[model samples]
Target: MVTLKHDSHEHELNLTEVDAYMVGKGKCGVCEMQINEASSIYKCLREDCPNNSLSLFFFLHKSCAELPKQITHPHHPQHSLVLGREYNQEIVKLTRGSLPHLTACKLCSRQIDEQMWNYFCKACSYEFLLPTNAYLHIFTFSLCIRCAIMEPAIHHEGHKHHRLTLLRRQLSLICDACGITKENDFCYSCLPCQFWIHSSCAASPATIKLRFHQDDTLHLIYSVPHMYRSFTRHCQICKNEVLKDKWAYFCEDSGYFVHITCARTLLAYGENEIKHEAEEEEEDYAQPHPDLLQFPLPSTDSLVANLLAYHQLKNPSTITNPIAEEPVIQHWSHEHHPLVLSEKSTFKGDADSDDDENDDILICNGCTTPILNQHKYYQCIRCNYFLHISCANHLPIKFPAGKCLADPDHSLNLDKLEIKLGRNLSIAFCHSCHLPTNGFGYRCNSCSKLTDIICCLLPDKIKHDSHKHALVQHFNHPSFKMYQNICTACLAPVLDGFDYRCETCIDVQIHQHCAMLYPKSITHRFDSHTISLLYPPIYYKGIKYCEICELQVNPEAWLYWCRHCDQCFHPNCIRAWHNMKLGDKIFNGGIHRHKLTLVAIDKDRYPQRIHKSLACNQGHDNGSSLDVYLECAGCFFIL
Candidate 1:
C-alpha cells in the first residue's frame, strides 16, 4: 500500500501503479494533460471510500508521480518552491508592482495559468504584500511544468558557436543576450568564452514584431552593426543607452533597437498596443492650447494659477495648504503667527528666558538640532518657533506614489507623526530609521506608516567612503535574504531598519545611519590624537590590534585609527567608550541587591584571582585584563 498526496484530493490517496487501460481514458491529475493508452499511470486503489460513488479517482503519469513535492529553482533560489494549485488574485494585485515578473514563468517568460498546478515559494507569498510597517522583501516566483522539466543541455541559437551546458550554482553575471546582470542559481554557459545567458533569453524568438513597431520586424543580433555605431543609439522600448558591443533585437530597416529583456517583458504582458495608445494620448494632451501659447507675457502667478487649477481638478486636498504659496506661512507647530524666512539670526528671548548669555544658540524645532548662524532660518515673530531653512524646505505637502520609499505604491501626506498613531499605540516609528518620533513626518493613511523628515530627505543613491561603488538605498530588498543582516561598517546585526547596499559588491551593505551619520573623526579618551575613520586596504606590515578593545583589527574592515599615535580601534569600541565613565552606578537587581559601581580589574595586580574567579565555567582566559567589572556598592563585592 502506498500513500499519494495530490492537489485535487482532500485526503491522501492509496495508489498503485497500473496501465492506462486499467484506469481508462482520462487526463493526468498533475499536468491536466491527456494520458496515452500505452503509458503506465498511478491510480487510486481506495475503492471503499465514502466518496467513491462520486467517482473521485486520482490518476497521474508515471513521470508526473515522481515529481518532488518541493524544488529549488534557479530563478528564485532564496526559498524552496512547493508544488501548489491555488492562485489568489488579491495577493497578486498587491505584489504586482514589486514582483511584476512573477505573473509569468521565470524560465520561459510565458504567462502562468492560474488553474494549472505550479511551483511557488509559500513563504514569499505570505509576506510579499504586507503593509509598509512590516518588512517588504518579496520575490514571488512561479514555474510552469514545461520550463521546470527543460533539458539540462541544449544548443541555443543565441550562442550557436557552442552547446551551452546548464550550471546549477548561484552566479552573478551579465547575460550575453540581455546584457543584464541577474543573480540566478541556474544559467546555461559556454565555459570557453565565459558566455552566460538566462534560460528565457536563450529561448527568446529569433524575430519579434511589436505593436509599437508594427511596420518593422526586429531580428535578434549578436552585436550592433558598424554602420549603426556612427551615432549614439538608445533602446526604443526602455529609452536606455544601447551598448554597441552587446546583443540586442535590431531592425535595420527602421534602425530600431530593443533590449532582449524589455522585449520579453512586453511580449509576455502583451501591453504594447495599450501602452502605445496611452503614450499617444499623453503626447496629444501635453500640447498647450493655441490661445495660451500665443501670448509670451506671463508672470510666476500664471504658473501658480495653472497648478492650482490642475490640482483642484485632480485632488482638491493636495492644494489646500497655502504655506507653500506664501513667504510668511503658518506652520503646524507654530500657528500663532506666520513664520518669516530671514537670512540673519533671530535672537528673540523665550518666555522663560532670564539671561542674554545663551541667546547666541538657536535650536530648530523640526530636527531638534542647533542651527548655525551662517545658515538661513525661519522664525516666528511672537514665539520661539524656529526652523532651519533646509528643514523648512524639506517638508513637502505630499509625496506622490512611488516617490517615497516608506510606501512606494501609495502617496504619503505630510502630517504629525502622533496623528497617524492609533489610539492603542502611543508611539510612531519611522519606516526607514525605525526610530520613534512625534514630530512632523510623512504618513501613509492607508497603511499607517510614518517616515521621519530626516529619513525622508535621504537620497536614493549615496557614495560612501567605505566602498568604491555607490550604495543604493533599499527599503526591504529580496537580496538581503541571501546574506546575513549584518552591517559591514559597524559589524553589528541589523534585524530591522533600512540599509544601503552596493549592487556591484553584493556582500557590501551598511546601515543607513552608519553610512551617513557617523562622524569622520573623533577624539577618544584612550588616544591623545584624533582618530579618523579608516577605510579598507590598510598596508600595515603585521596584524593590527585595537588600542581600546585590545583585540585584533581586521585591515579590510573600516575602523577608527590615529596615524600620529600609531593606534587602531574598532568603531564599536570607540562608540561604547564615548560617554562612558569609571565608577558609573548600574542598578541590576538580578546580579546584586544594591547599585553596582563600574570598576576595572588590573591584570598585573590580580591576574590569578581574576583568572580563577571571573573566568567562564570552562576556565578560558586570554591573559589580558583591561576588563571592566561591576562592584556592589553595599557589600563592596566584585560582580
Candidate 2:
C-alpha cells in the first residue's frame, strides 16, 4: 500500500498494486483506457472518496499512477504545466465566451470532459487583468494526458528518408502528405527538406482500396511520376487539380490519382488494405508528341499544307518530307496577301541598313508586341503587315467551345482592331486581367468577352515574389470556399474570375492579373526613390498613410513602400498614376468638361484658391480641401 496526495481530490488516495483482473473490469481514471486483465494496476482502496462510487471504483494503470505532477511541454517551454482536472475557472471563462467548443486539446484537437485529467499552462490563465476579449489573442495551451506524453520524434512510413521532429508551434503551412492546410495546428516536420505533415496525415496507411476504384489498390507515393508531369491531371475524388509535387495515392494501371485527405475518408470501410510489400517498379509511360497549335487551323488543304510546310522549313532536321516551294503562308490576320518569310529587315528604305531605327520597333499584329529583327518573321511586301514566326505557327484562329472560362458554351474567334485617333475605339477589356486593350484577343461572339493573348497563355502554376510558395491557379473551386475570397495584393474582393492562391498560406489569394502583371517595384511620381511592394506586418512609428491619396493604408495588407523615403502608397494609387499618362483626356458629362486633359498641379501655389473653394464647397464653412485635382489645359480652369 502507498499513500498519495492527488491534486484533483482532497482525500489521500491509498493505492495498492494488484492485477487488473483481481479488481474486476475497470477503466483507468487518468488515461481513461481499459485496464486489461493480468496487467499491473494501482487500485484505489479508499471507499468513501468522491472519486469512488458503489458501481465503480477509481483505478489507474501503473504508468498512469507514476505520471509526474508537473511536466515541461515543448509547445509551452516558458513555464512548467501542472497536471490536474479541468476545473480552471479562467479557462472556463476564456473558452465559454469565445471558443466554439467547451474544452479542446490543442495537440489532438479532441474535446475533453470537465472531470478528465489534462496538462494546462497555469501562467496563461492568470497573466491578464483585463476582459477576456481584450487578450483573446493569447492562446491557452492544453493537452490531454495521452498527447502530453507523445514522443518528440517519430518515423513515418510516407517519408522513409529521415525522422520527423515534432514542431513546437502551429504555422501557416500545407501538409505535404494530404495537400490540406489546417490553420493553427501542430505538425511533424523534417527541417532539412522543409517537409511538413499533420500528425494524422503522417499516420495514413500505405495502401488504401477506394470503393470507387475496386479493381486495384491505390498506393501512396511521395510525388507524381516524372512521365505524368507534362499532362495536367485532376483528383479522382474532389475533381480539383492535383498538385504534382505533393503526396498522393496513385493507381498505376488506371492513372487514377487522389489526394490523401480525399482518400482517407474511405479507409475506415476498406479492410485488409495495409500492404507492407515494397512498392513495385514504375512502368515506363509513352510520352505524347507536343502539339504546336493550341487552336484549330483552316481546314483548306492548301492552307494546312502551307502551314505544315513552314514548320518543315523551320526545322529541316526533324522533317524528312520536303515541300518544293518557298514558305509563303497566308495568315488569318492578313488573309488578303500571302506573307513571305524574311530573315533581314524588310522596311523599304532600311533594307541594307543594320542601324536600329524607330521603325524597327514595329508591333506584331497578332499579339500586339514589338517584333525583333533577330527572329525570323513573315512580312507582306504589298502591305505593312508582319507576323512573328511563333504567332503564325501556333496562334489559333478560333478557340474551341468550352476553352474560355468566361463563356464556356461558345467558341471565341481571334479578333484585332487598330486604335486610331479619329476612329471610334471600341475599348475591350481582357476578361482575365481586366485591363483595357485594343490588341489582338480571343472574343466570344455570344457574350462579347475578350481575353488578351498574354492572359490566355498563363500557366496553371506560377511563382510570385510576394509569396514564398508557388501559387496554384483556382477557378472558384469548392475546396477554397472556406477561405475568404479576397486578393492579398490589392485587398479587393475576388469575384467570379480566376485567382492564384498559395497552397501553403490559407489567407493568400491573389487576382490573376495582380499576381502575374503587377510589377514588384515601380518609380512613382510622388517619390524620387523606387517603391517596392511589401507584405503584411509592416512596422512603423506612426499611422501609415498613402503618399499619393493621403489616406490611411492598412499595414496588414500589401502596399508599396519606399524604405529610403519612409513613405507608403496604395497599390491602386500607383497603378492609377501609371495608367493615366500626361495629356490623357477624360470626359465627365456631369462635371463641365470639354474633354479634360490630365495635368499635374501644385496645391501650395494656389493656397488662396483652395481656401476659397473649400469654403464654397462646404457652404461658407471651414472644411478640408482636396490635395490633388486635374486642371483643365484649355482654359486653365481647375476641375
Total backbone clashes of candidate 1, pairs 3 or more residues apart or in separate chains:
0
How high is each candidate's TM-score?
A: 0.32, 0.34
Question: Global CA lDDT of candidate 1, please?
Answer: 0.58
Tens-digit lDDT string for candidate 2 (90-164): 556655646534367876666666778988877765344456345422337778886787667898776789999
lDDT scores for all predictions?
Answer: 0.58, 0.58
Please give the clash total of every predicted structure, in order.
0, 0
lDDT of 1 by residue, 558-614 (tens): 787898988988765554321112333566575557876555454643454364545
Model 1 ranges off by over 4 Å = 1-330, 336-364, 367-374, 378-386, 403-407, 419-425, 477-483, 519-531, 537-639
Candidate 1 differs from the real structure by a C-alpha RMSD in angstroms, to one decimal, of 26.7
- The superposed Cα distance between candidate 2 and the true structure at residue 228, in angstroms, equals 51
